[model samples]
Target: MEEFTIINENNEFKKGKVISVFNISNSNREIVLFSSEDFDSENANLQIAYLNIDADGYNYISQIDDEKVLKEAMYIVKDMIEVINNG
Candidate 1:
């Protein structure tokens, strides 16, 4: 699996697998990343990320309409990956 190098605001680094990349159009794109199995199936939109992860057995950070949340989540995930890499 291809891994992504993520750096958080606290100078943390993390590695995540790229689950899937959705191409809305030629110029628009989105991806989903998952670090664990904790996923919800009820909400379609919310689970879009998880579905991509589960369907492909990979992880990826998404680029969706909500840039703020994606950035925050990416920060946290990067921090967590740093901890795992360090230890």
Candidate 2:
């Protein structure tokens, strides 16, 4: 699976693999990241949303919500994989 990561506005760590990606009914793209550790279902949903923002090629949206820290950290770690792939 592919991987990518991003630092949340609050500066936390999130790590996960790109389990899958697909478009919703509206054609909006969505990405999923499965956390490397255990977390509640709510946290999982937040992580999905946060990482989506990070991976959508909008690298300049400042100030992600505080609840998204774990998700962000996961994405940032996954992003390291992307860096490695490119290099």
Candidate 3:
């Protein structure tokens, strides 16, 4: 499993598993899906981040603040993984 460190709105870093990676062909963008399981709270939080690749090929997730977009990305990631697994 791939691991990722995500920064929340408060600028706190949270470590999670990289559940999925999505490529946006039209825009040349990559979206990463993260699943942060909080065992203490018995909750699983989903986070969506944009993978920004520099000219030299170094990449990182950009900061995001839209909840709606994050939720949509989570759905997209789940669907994508489901399709891949089913096929």
Candidate 4:
């Protein structure tokens, strides 16, 4: 898994290991799942972050707060699981 650094709105920094990546169909956007003690010491939750990948392969991280986007992401992940299991 790749490592990632997160800079919150308060200018605080956190480090974590990337769990997985999912590309949204027909879009340049992707969601990366990662985990860090900075989020929760017990690691009770899985956190997700979004980014936009440009044509040149550059990516810019952007926080996602929209419910519809999140629901779509969840469905994408579910579909991925189905593919893996059926394979």
Residues 1-87 of candidate 2: C-alpha lDDT, one tens digit per residue? 354345544675444445444333432434343433223333532334333445666522233345445455456556756887997
Model 4 misplaced stretches (Cα beyond 4 Å): 9-12, 25-28, 39-45, 54-57, 75-87
Query: What clash count goes with each model?
Result: 3, 12, 0, 0
Per-residue CA lDDT of model 3 for 1-48, tens digit only, reads 377665667775666787667864433557877776653466678767
Full ranking by TM-score: 3, 4, 2, 1
- Tens digit of lDDT per residue, candidate 1, span 27-82? 33344553322123322112223223546766445434566655654665566568
What's the TM-score of each model vs. the native? 0.32, 0.33, 0.56, 0.54
lDDT by residue for model 4 over 1-87, one digit each (tens)? 266676666786667676788777644677986665465455433666796667898765667787777788877777776898998
Report lDDT (Cα) of residue 38, candidate 4.
66
User: Where does candidate 2 have its weakest 10-residue lDDT segment?
Assistant: 37-46
Q: Global lDDT for candidate 1?
A: 0.45
**What's every prediction's RMSD, in angstroms?**
14.4, 12.5, 4.1, 4.1
